[model samples]
Target: MKSSMATPVTVSDITENPHKYQFKQINDMTGQSILNSFDAVFISNSVAFNGGLNVLKDSIYHETINKDMRYNINIIKTAKKNENNKELKKLVKLFHSKEIQEYVGKKFDHKKVEVKKQVSYLK
Candidate 1:
């Protein structure tokens, strides 16, 4: 019989979670540089493997396909701009609220009538 659910935790799953996974600062820089150098070497080797310098004359094309990648940058930018405008409007309304205006000695108007603050009596 097959198991209903496999083990929830996996090594790859743990590595991908930013909150749980962290790289050492030293290792991050050094490892990245090493990886970059290796990538450069690989590129050099790949070119050398396929007829050294003659591959460029044929106009050979090499494409790296990333099926998982999707970009909606325009949508994100538009959404942010819209949200910021909404937040600004909310702030303006908050500052214009009755309690806030009173603190700043500002008066409210309605029907060409101004409401005056009632004087507090001391007992």
Candidate 2:
């Protein structure tokens, strides 16, 4: 009952029926970060594994939400001035390639994704 679902705001908002909150015991749900909140990424048991971490039956869960609180995000970015940079373009293409997407899915438990870039430099 101590996950994000039971945070002050959630509990206060649903005082009468707070028990209805899905994660109230041995929760793998996420909560606020120690130093970051806005746009912060919190991975739940369901996010990093198939069928949620509940069935992992591995000690990895000990390092997950219920035990530790650490989160990180990687944002790939290119400056506007690099619009026509061939090397950067190639790198981005490689990143969104099917092979890389599959690697990401296997390692991160995320779905395949593609990025399409449209150039309007003439505008």
Candidate 3:
């Protein structure tokens, strides 16, 4: 006759039990600075490509994995209709301008994300 033993469970084993785990959401600055504190850190391409990690010494390694992140320019109909919204309209127009697009392209790595043609909605 042999005695039977039970297997020990881990945090992953209790997937359905919310109380078994502790969760905390840290700001981007803290989270990026402390990569070793967690198993993994996830970030958007804009952050990664724009030298967000340049502040840290060569303690971390990164790779560029292409992701589809669409950038858009939108204006609310109500804002467009209001005559007093000249400033808002001016800002929107600037966003659609070629100069602004070029600036954005330079700001964010153009190789990863491209600025497509601007779309306008006229009444």
List lDDT for all candidates, in order: 0.33, 0.44, 0.47
Task: Give the per-residue lDDT of model 1 (tens digit) for 1-123.
Answer: 111124422233433454553432232224323543442221221233232322223223422222211120111123445756876667656755777666544221210111222122110
Shift of residue 42 alpha carbon in model 2, Å: 8.0
Which prediction has the highest TM-score against the true structure? 3
Report the Cα lDDT for residue 89, model 1: 62
> Candidate 2: deviation at residue 106, Å?
2.3
Higher-lDDT candidate of 2 and 3 = 3
By lDDT: ranked, best first = 3, 2, 1
Model 1 reaches what TM-score against the true structure? 0.19
User: Which is better, 1 or 2, measured by lDDT?
Assistant: 2
Identify the candidate with maximal lDDT. 3
Checking candidate 3 for backbone clashes, the offending pairs are none
> Candidate 2: misplaced stretches above 4 Å?
1-75, 109-123
Candidate 1 global lDDT: 0.33
Order by TM-score, highest first: 3, 2, 1
Error of 1 at 77 (Å): 20
Deviation (Å) of 118 in candidate 1: 29
